[model samples]
Structure formats: structure tokens, C-alpha cells
Target: MSTQQEQLDFIERHLVYDIFKDFGPEASLEFHKVECSNGLDGFMSALYTVTLELVIRERKRTEVVLVKFMKGTEEFRESSNSYIQFANEIFAYAEILPAYENVLRTSHLESEVVSNWVPRCYFARFGQVEGLSNGRESVLALKHLKNDGYQLGPRLILRRDHLEAMVGLIGPFHALGYATRILQPQVHARLRAGVVDMPFVSESGKAIFDVLYRVAFDRFYEFYDRQKEQLLKDTDPGFGAAIERLREKYFKQPTQLLEWIRTNSYAADQADSHFATFLHGDYNRNNVLFHYGADDKVDGIKAIDFQELRFSTTAIDLSFFLYMNTASEGREEIYAELLRKYHSHMIQMLELVLRRNQDELTDDRGAELLKEYSFERFNGHFKRYAFYGALVCMHFLPWLLGNEKDCAELSRLFDTDMHGPAFHQLSMDIAGDEANEEIFKIVRHAYEHGYMDEI
Candidate 1:
């Protein structure tokens, strides 16, 4: 293991020099001081908060940046089917977001604008570090949003306004994808081509998924059994059977829909035109940071962590946010309202793109175009992946809701093997948390919406 000083030395010599060279000659940028501190711990990367005192072009300034490094253990990095994750993150920061913004900037959309919903990326490199070889030393430097008054939401339960704030951000994000598909077909195609094939579709990922599914399903069923009385009483009579059927058909098999998504993930025929945009595959409460306004209410939200970006429907992002963060009470109360707002923003953004494209609204062609990009079509695709929403909740809620100690233990346990008994125990512990009712609400919603039958 490298000493702390050694790591600091590496940052100063390599990272700092790279940033300085971007502006002008190295001498033009004088570095005076540097300090580094631990950042938020992620599952697959180590983050550092690097502060720098510098003079550039006679202007003295202090800069703080968050550096993400693929510094996981060799065993975990190699074993977890992480080959494409780093590349996916780098692609999102370096290419995808910029392309989306460029589409907006170049368009004649008088009413709409592209907001910076994610942190500004300063630099991204793969296979740069000398000793951290085999693509393990990938690094990303991003503006530290926390320095600008952004903070994480309470992980236990997200409030209604917080959920709305996130919805507001994601709505435009998905709309960009829809707009790009219509306005700049070539750009959209290029982005679609670049979506990293989810590791779970591969042979090794298949093995991992097998183990992961078994343990995840076991925990899920255990949670169901524990709450059988209340859930059956409060939910539809079909709840218990639907859960069991999904376990057997989807989780046990694991590929029924996996193959479908893989085969059709990128196909863009009008018949099944659901795969429209680059989705933040890991949209959750922890991945979003909130900016509080003067009233102490959340006024803005920014997303972080792009390792799970996928060329999929907006529903994937929407369902993940809704099920993962919002409590049952909040979801039940505001689910329709949230969807309506998200759909409205998406339509507004799409209209801007349509206007820029100069597509005639009175003609049959324009009507077809609007229908193709309609919210009803998007809802159809979202419901199709409702099974995935529930599955992700079962696999993720444990870690998200666990206490610090439990989270640490759970992370350490699952980092190596997915099917270990200890993993199931920890997952069960997570499902047993009272917060699980929130997730159950998601599952219940899915069933009520006929997602259970469709899956």
C-alpha cells in the first residue's frame, strides 16, 4: 500500500501538473499549497477532496476538486465484472453530457435551456497511473459541489420536496435524450452506440447474477414472509402470489427480460422505440445532492456517479428514483403528480427540439413525430421495466438503509462473493428494517399497475 505522503506526491506531480498545463505553460500556473482529505466512500472507487492554493496568470485562487480513483482491491476490481464501469463514467463526463448540452446550445429552443444537473468534470483519464495497471487506475476530476452548498439528503427517508427537486432535474435530462433523437439523429445514434453493455449481460456477469439473484431473492422472500400479514392485509390479494411468481419467472431465470433488453437495448425500430436516451442507471437518493434555498427548502439537485449509465428508457431512471428514495406515504400521495410534472418537462423540452428541427406541427408527419415521443409511449416502456425497479430495490435497499456499521459490513461482505450466507444474513437484516415498507409500496404499485402480470 502506498503511504499517504506518496499519494499526495503523485497528485501534485501528475494531477496538478495536468490541470495547470490545460491553461498555459506550467510556469504560468504556480502552485503554493495542497491538502487532501477523504471524500464519500463509493462501492467501486475511492474519492478524495483535493484543495489547492495557486496563482495562475497573476491571479491567486483557491480550488477544491473531487478526485475519483478506481482504487478498489485488485480481487474485487477484477472479479466484480467492472471492466466497462470506469469507461462508462468517463464517457458520460467527457462526451455524453457535453453532446447533450451542445444539442441544446445549437438549437433555436427559445423557451428551454440545458441546466447543469451534474458536477462539471475537469478531467478524466483511463490507465494513467503507473502502478495501478489493467485499467484499474482510471481517474476522474470533478468540481466539488459541496463547496457550493450542496449536500446529501437524509438516507433513511426522503421528503416530498426533495423527491420533486430530483424529479425536476431528471425530467429535463430524459427530455434531452428524446429531443436529441428527433433533432440530431446522428448525435443520438453515436451516444446510443457508446452505451456500455451492462456487465450482467456477459458470461461472467451471468455467473455473478446467478449468485446475486439467489441471495437477493432469498432476502426478498424473507422480507415478504416477515411482512406477509400486513402486506396481504393492506395490499391487493394478488401481492403474495405476484411476488412469488416474479421470483420464479424473473429472478430465478434472470434472463427472460435480460435477453430482451440486451437484444433490443439499442434497436430503434418504431414498433418498440423505447430505448431513447442515456439513462443514469444508478439514480438514487445517495447519488443526488441537494442545494438548499434561503427558506431552507431544497431548490436544486445535482446527480453524481455515472458508472451505471445505460442506453435505456427514461423509465429506468424515473423508477429508480421513485422506488429507491421516496417513502410509501410520499409516493402514494404524489406519484401521479410527480409523473405529470416529469412528463410535462419532457414534453416541453421535446417541443423545443421539434421547433428547432422545423417539423411542421399541422402535418401528419408532425403528428406521428409527437406520437412517437409521447408520454404515453414512455409510460409503456417504464411499466415494462417495473420488474427491474422492484428487483433493484431488493438488492439495494439493504445497503441504502443500513446503519453505518451494517453498511460497512454489507459492503465488505458483498465486495467479494454474492452468494455467501453472510451476504443473505445482512440483506435480511436490511429488509427487516422498518423502512422496507417504502420499498414494499413500490412493489405494490407495480402490481397494481399490472407490472406484475407483464413481467
Candidate 2:
């Protein structure tokens, strides 16, 4: 373990010094190591450094900044680098900033255009370090919104207002991608190549997917086996049929399903004639921070976690937010309205991108792209991919819900000898009636859309 003095020494060498020079000889810093009993895979610690200043300076003020440090195991560190490389590839066409100026300017311009919908980026940087065998680190310094707070993670239920705010932000974020396509066509093309035709098909991603699918299948069977009686007694006949049909199709023929996935994994690799633009791959509520007033209505929203940014269909982002955020009981009622809102915002932004960069993309081509890649068409893909999404939800829900007990059983079923089964089990335990209903709704939506047709 790194001692307090050792940590302080590391900080003295790394942190900007002019900000800390004012502290008297007796002034000391405080360190707090946050325990993520919640079972997340990362090392997070918050440092609160307080210093007293002399009277000589024109500004005699105390300085306090919260530094959140995240570190990973050797394997995880390597994986994080690969992830950063992927992000860098997406931004290759655009200028990436070590300072906040460029990102701030871009964000301000976007906010003005979109009005009520933009996230603020404070600072971002990538550099090498001496610790852990001189590995590189990517650090993002963000404005700490003490007043604004975040809701529960994606697994939890989302309020109507929360849903509305999130949907509103999607329009402008997607528009930014479209704008990039027009203003920087060549860059956009590069991003398209890098994002859609991801090396996942060829790289370690193939092995990762192979393992993930097998684990997913095994878990599905365990869940099915354990809940067989309950499934038979399910009140909704349609729901029972859907589950059984899925089991008969996928459970008995796991290899066939895996083969099918392997075949279609490259389906979106080729950028179709449809519109392609920048996409926030994991645009869930968890990544969206909400600013709420006394009334609990959303005043502002900012997005975090750019780890999954890529170039692809706008619908991919929209569907992720919708499926992950919305609950079961009210989803059908709000789905149409939310979809309409997303479309309207997207078209408006698309128009802006075209108008600003007339030479790059003609109005006709832009409109054609927009129409071809409309949300309606994309929803079809969402329905088809809903099973995969559900599988992901099932696997992680226990951890998210803070159910640690059943995590071991869940892990064993997945054929992974890793720890943290308890955390996943805790998550499953915490998922209340509302979450169950939400899961059912998603499954029903898939069924109604004929997602199980082939089965």
C-alpha cells in the first residue's frame, strides 16, 4: 500500500506546483481512499488538500481541489490503453485537446445552437508516468457539479423528467456527429472506417465475444432451470410463450446462435448508403449527469464517459438510451413521443451541419442520409438486437442492484472463475418490482416486434 507520505511525494512531482506553493511549512494535505464496496473494477481515491496562504500576495485565498485517481490491474491497464486507442482513432479527424479551450469553444457553440442541451468538458489529457512500469494514463478534469447530482445507474428506473432530458440531449449530440461529417468530410470518412468496421472482428474482440456468448448462454440456462416452475406459472401467457420459444431456439441450439452471431457480427462493418456519424456507444443515464432544482425537474444535463465514442448510425445511440433508461409500465405510452422528439432534434441539427458546410455535402445527399438512417428504421435493428441487450442486462443487473450473495452462483453459471459474484448477486436482489416490470416490457417489445420470428 502507498503510504500518505509516498502519495504526497507523488502528488508533489505530478500536480502543477504554482497552485500549491502558498501553503505554509506546517500546512498538510488529507487523503481519503474511497472504498467501492459496490464491486466496481477500478481503484478510486479522493484527495483533499488544504493549504494556508501568506499575506504578501494580492489574492490570499485557500485552495481546495478534489482529485479522483483511478488505477487498474496490469491486465486492465492494457485493456484501457486499447480502449483509449480506439477513442483516439475516432477523434483522429478532429483536433483533440490537452487543454480545455478547444473543447470549451466547441461545447459553447453547440449549446447556443441546441439551447437546453449540452454537456460541459473541463479538461482532458494523455501522458506517460513512472508508476506501474512507466505506463501511460489518460486523465479528464471535469467541472465538479456539487449542486447537480446523478440518478441511479442504468439498471435503475428513470423518472419521466429524467427520460425527457436525456432524449433531448441525444438530438444535439447526434447532430454534432452530422456536423462533423459535413465540416470535415475526410475526417468523417476516417472515423466511419475506424468506428463501424471495428477491429473487434479481427482482434482480441473475437475471443472476448466467444467467451462472452458462451457465458451468456450458460447463465440463461441456469436462470431458466432455476425458474422453470415460476416460468410455467407465469401469469402472462404471451410472456411464457416468448421465454419458452427463446429457450427452445437458443438454449437447445447455443452453437447455432453463436454461429449466427459470428456471421452477422460484421453486418454493420460496411458503411451502408445510410447516414454515418459520430456516436456515443454507451449513452445510458449513468453517463448523463442531471442538474435538478428544488422542483426535481431537470435544469441541465452533461454527458460523461467518452470511452465508447465511435462513428455509426445515430439510431444506435438513441436505442441504447431508450432501452436502458425507460421503464416497462410507461414505455409504450412515452415511446412514440420520445421518438418524435429525437427525430425532430436530429433533423434540425442535420440541417445546421449541411448549411454550415455546403461544399462538403450537398443538401440532397444530407437529406437522403437522414431519411435512410431514420430512427424508425433503426428501431427495427434495436428490436432484433434486444436479446443481446437483455442478456447484458441480466448479467450485470445483480452487480448494479448490489446483490452480492447470488453473484457467485451467477459467475459459476457464466463459467468465469473470477471474483465479484457477490456484488452481482446483490444487484439482482435490489432490482425491485419496477425493474422486473421494465425487463418484462423490454422482452415483450422484442416479442411483439417479431424478434423471435426465426426461432
Candidate 3:
């Protein structure tokens, strides 16, 4: 009966020895294990290992490969299976680059032509072959990244040049969605089904969403107060009044708000649109990885985290990306430019998808549906829902702001510091100037756009 840590150590050694057996005793191996701490559930820990060896047959060849392992309890084994199945499905459709190959290749090719965006696929599998019963299991794999990098949550915030180069990468992702719709209508439909209505449909899941939404809104109000005062002093009476009205309409009417959410929760299958295609659900700076050149110019951009991929108005993803990533100071100035770039890429993709599936898309009805479901209008139409989005954003903002130490301070105000200082620290970190400004901007935007009135 070895302890979990001891078992982990033994497993690592065994894996290294088994995989690099040809390297003989001279082969070197290193292991690093990081506990999942960002409120992530259902896992023991994530481990990274590096093995170095020289090929005995090819004496001149030396190689170093990295392996990732997901270790978890028996309970997690079931959930891990679901996750593995999902990952396998994604991999089956697209080659697994260390990051996103299609996005990187599309961007690279647009700037400088490339033959193909597909990557060389390696093996992928769950940790347990027999599956966990009562103990823990370790799943592992190896891969090579052409570029050394780390992920910022779901997004890849790599070197600066990588960020800029990503603009081109977006083109190809948009292209692929369009191409899929045209060339493989049934496949596209199936992918859409997989994305929008995947398993997570339990009543408990809905309750969790409700709780998250409430937490998000409460946090938004706390931040919104600062902006209300500022706008009042600045003589923006209309904006101030709108905020008050919105508070009355939505925040004060929690029951009504929940009812509205429940009513609108179902996916809408409105009039057809030609522009519809697979949308990157969580497109943002965080989800994108950039390869940089000298002076921080982006040489390449790779979009990752396709777990939320689904069929929707392209505007949903594009708007979210711009709103979340762009700075507040320059947002208004760059809004049109961003929209232009997004739409241009989207239009090109739509055309390509149509061209490939001329017979399937011959109806032109889909295009009309898309035109009617314009992102700008959708944003305005769903501004109340922005509260929901903003709430989700708040959950991650503390990490983004690099504040996890002030949780205790926040807990003091709440009367019980069950989570101790860490919770307060996170709250304090996220309650910074930038976050406040962003929250206020959203509040003000919602007010001015008449979202408050209808809510």
C-alpha cells in the first residue's frame, strides 16, 4: 500500500524506463508535478516530464521529449473518460498540434504561403487502460512543440510577435468553418450538434450556472458603483439614470432575470443565414498563442481550446474576442477596424464554404439568416446576457490581474473567511483600476444601449 506520492514517483520512473529503454542507463529523465489549484475539480495533479537520450543505433542523434500526465482519483476516472472521449473526437477531426495547427497554418499561409496546416499526429489516450476503480490512475503522453511556450489559461499568451501574427491565423480558422459547411454539410451539422448541445445537460449543471450567474452579477454591482459616481460627476445624467434603471430592472428583479435566462437558454434556430459556420466559442487573447519575431512582431498566431466550438452567428465569437482583449482606452477608436478585419475574414470563409458546397448551400437562405443575426445587433439584443458573460469573466479576472493573495480581505467584508486570505487576495487583485474600468464600461454600455429598459 504505497502512498499516492510514492505511487506517482514509481509510475514516473517506470514510464521513463519503459519509453526510453533503448537509451540504456545513460538516458536522463526529469519530472515536475503541479497540483491543480485554480478551483479546478476532479484531478489529483498534472505532471510534466522530460526525457533525454541519444539513439544507440544512430549515435549522432540526441532527442528530448516532453510528456504530460493527468493523475486523478477514482471518482475522476469517470469524468476523465468523458474528457478523453471529447478530446479524441476533436483530434479525430483535426490533427493535434502542440497547439492549434489550422489557425497557425492559415495565418502563416496568408502572410507567406504554406502547403498544408495539418500537423503530424502522435498518440493520445486515457491514463487507465482498465480504468480506475478505487485508487488513482496516471495518464501520460509525449509531444514536441516547435516553439517553446506556456498557456495562460485556455489562451496561449506567448511572445509579442506571436500575438500580431495571429491576425492571419484567424483567416484560416474562419476559412475552415466555411469550407466544412460547403464541402461536408452532414459533417458540419454533426460538429455543430457536438458543440452546442453536448453532454452537461443535468439539472444540477443548470443550478451551477445559476449560482455562477448570481455571483457574477453581485460582483459586477460592487464594481459598478464606482463608475456610477464618476459618470454622475461628469454630467452623464442619461448614463447614470440608465444604470439606476438597469439595476431596478435586472439586478433588483433576480427572479425575473432568472426566468428570462431560463426562457432564452435554449438554442435559437431562427431564419437561415449564409454566414453561419463553426465559431470559436471562447476567442480571446488568452485562447490564442502567438509566435513572435524581433521587437515583438507576431510571426504566427495559433488558436486553441476548441471545446466550445459550435454553430452560431460569427459575431458572437468575434465580438467577445475584441471586447475582452482590446484595451478600454483604444476600444472605441479600434472597434470599426477590428470589426472590419473580423468580418472580412468571415466573409472570405463564407464564400469559400459556399464555393466548396455549392450544391448544399445553393439556397442562399443561410446567408440571409446570418445577415439577420448580425453580431452588432446581437450584442445589442443580448446586452442583458452580457451580465452573464461579464460574470464568467470575473471568475478568471483575479488570475489575470495576478492577485490571489487578498482573498482574506474580501472574506472579512463577507463576515466569514471560510476560504481564508486567499479568497480576499483574489478579490482585491481583481478589484483593480483596469477591472473597475472594464466593469463600469460594460455597465454604462448596457445602460446606453437600452438593455436596462427591457430587462
Model 3 agreement with the true structure over 1-455: per-residue lDDT tens digits: 12346534643555445555645675443433323222221122344434344445445443344333444333332432434333433543343232223333433424322212222223233334332222333344433334344233233122323323444455546556655555555756656555523332234332223333344556666766645565467645776666566567766434355444333433454323444455565666655555555754555454544444544445446545545555556555565565555555645654544443445555676575345435564444444343433433544454354443443344333333222344444454555766656656645554554445545
Q: Which candidate wins on lDDT?
A: 1
Q: Global lDDT for candidate 3? A: 0.45
For candidate 1, write residues 108-129 as lDDT tens digits. Answer: 5434444368876778866546
Model 1: how far residue 441 lies from native, Å: 3.0
Model 3 worst lDDT window (10 residues): 34-43
Tell me the lDDT of model 1 at 114. Answer: 49
| Residue 72 lDDT in candidate 1 | 50
Over 4 Å off in model 2, which ranges? Answer: 1-11, 17-70, 78-123, 127-133, 147-155, 190-216, 225-276, 310-316, 359-363, 381-388, 403-441, 451-455
Find the 10 residues in a row with the least total lDDT in model 2: 34-43
Q: Which regions of candidate 3 deviate over 4 angstroms?
A: 1-45, 52-121, 126-167, 196-212, 235-238, 241-269, 272-279, 307-316, 356-391, 404-434, 445-455
Residue 439 CA displacement from its true place in model 3, Å: 2.0
Alpha-carbon local distance difference test for all models:
0.69, 0.49, 0.45
Cα-based lDDT at residue 203, candidate 2? 39
